[model samples]
Target: MGSGPTAVEIISHLNSSWQKVRGYQTETEVAEYRNGKLQITKSFLYSFRKPRDFRIDMHHPHRGTSLICCDAEGKILVRPGGIGAVFKKRLSPDNRLLADPSGQRIDQTDLGLLIRNIGHSLTDQRRGDMKVTDEGGRLVVESVASDHFLPGVLTRYRFVIEKGTWLPAQVVELTPEGVLKRVVTFGTVNLLSDFPPGFFISDREDRGGGGR
Candidate 1:
């Protein structure tokens, strides 16, 4: 459950993983192009083994999108259904975002910060004096209270990195009450040769004949 790996060590592992991923693959629905990019959109689903499911309308600009979800898996079900919504997005800046649309807020940063979090968690996990659980998992950084997700609660994190690519394939978030707050798993990475020309419309007016 515990390892000698320091925060630095975990960070290194995560960073190394990111480097392996040249980019993400996106799925599409009648894919189109505008402004020299591909616009792929679809309804997506993410599920965890413990019965957690997340839904999203994915709009992938380039790196593709994942319908991400998670929960305790393979029976021995501790929790299910997961918590909240997850929307994956990436930009030319190389930033990937998992956003909460209703929350009206998002972390502009993306994949790299996630790796740093893994490092931070690994460091904390190695602390000799922390509470130990026979069921192993990483700690969620900075918890708070309230209906948004409950107050003063701890959420444990678990994950799986893709082989060869090193991108995150799965992730989990569990509350102190053993309730699953979030779960996300990715699938079907599609490498496209070219995106549609109308893919990146600047404004409503630019939607052309497609405007509703």
Candidate 2:
């Protein structure tokens, strides 16, 4: 398949396919690339590292709560926070651990991202004409990449899929000001068939981390 893929075609190709990924009990290794360039490699345990935290919100005349996690070590990442978890980590795929101890759940729902969903990674594409640029408008940047993704505003973002992989190396969320609001870079991942039983959880040996 040549002739450059379209957005809809990309989604169709992705939805019709499923890749082999690892589970909680297994270790995973992932690799990151940028514009067909090698970036970084990381490994960790998914079950434990994937979950950051959980929350329950009982307010208004509605029942609501959410759980959050991040198994998207190497997959789609759309809209700052509007997508599902991606391909699970695959054990023995790469020579690295899959569980991550340093990761935080951040939210209540474990709704993480997938490899294909990374394409929807924009701020507000649904804002109709609200996401328009005024006369003589340009872009700004915090780093060399240029662009600051802002919060609660109409903006545009572009994600480039790496060739031969489902990973999106460079993600730039543009702000209403035309600057980058958020930029996420994917590093290499490690895949393992098995990991230590306790590697996924924090040891309760001392609940207090030398603090109250």
Candidate 3:
């Protein structure tokens, strides 16, 4: 607390940790709600490779196969056939709408990217408000005043990163005044030697052009 790693150091450590994980696949469970109502819970199986290429498959409540893929060209392919049809959209890295079902933009499965975003935001300003510490062998980081939060909501985030793996175990979203909001948990993660070709593409090659 009083004497610990600086924000920069914490960021550097997190970045290094992610570098060790060349590729991985895991199941992530997300529980989210808005304005004290409209709560929903869903699970996604995510697989990722370096430098912004990944695939997410939606499970349950929604029938059929729904998939989202992000390519190196910054294009997002959404196959909403379960809910609707397939579409492609060009969006920035931080686009909130990119998060399906849960509606929260933060990449719930990729803790490293989330930490990188937070680190980028906390640079050169009042960094003293943020703190990094260790709890029960896991590294914990918290920012009292952070802009890296859910839109329209003033909340602070606490990320619990596994010390050895450098991957996130859980993310806790809380109100500025410290009331709980959402909790996202990452399930058992398994490293992959390589991502197979077409792993990040829509199953139906014929599916084309923006929204159903």
The candidate scoring highest on TM-score is 3
Q: Which ranges of candidate 1 are over 4 A from the true structure?
A: 2-10, 20-22, 26-109, 124-153, 189-198, 201-204, 207-212
lDDT of 3: 0.63
Q: Cα RMSDs of all predictions?
A: 15.6, 16.3, 4.2
Off by over 4 Å in 2: 1-3, 12-19, 23-152, 206-212
lDDT of 3 by residue, 62-102 (tens): 53444454644455565554436534444444555554543
- Cα displacement (angstroms), candidate 2, residue 86, comes to 34
Model 2 lDDT per residue over 65-159, tens place: 11112222321111111232122222221222322221212231121343333324322133322121212222111112212222344434445
Is candidate 2 or 3 superior in lDDT?
3
**CA lDDT of 202 in candidate 2?**
25
Mind giving the per-residue lDDT tens digits that candidate 1 earns over 60-123? 3322333322212211111112242122122221112333421212232134455655554545
List the lowest-lDDT window of 10 residues for candidate 1: 71-80
Q: TM-scores across all candidates?
A: 0.42, 0.39, 0.73
- What is the overall TM-score of model 1 with all chains considered together? 0.42
RMSD of 2: 16.3
Superposed Cα deviation of residue 80, candidate 1 (Å): 30
Better structure of 1 and 2 per lDDT: 1
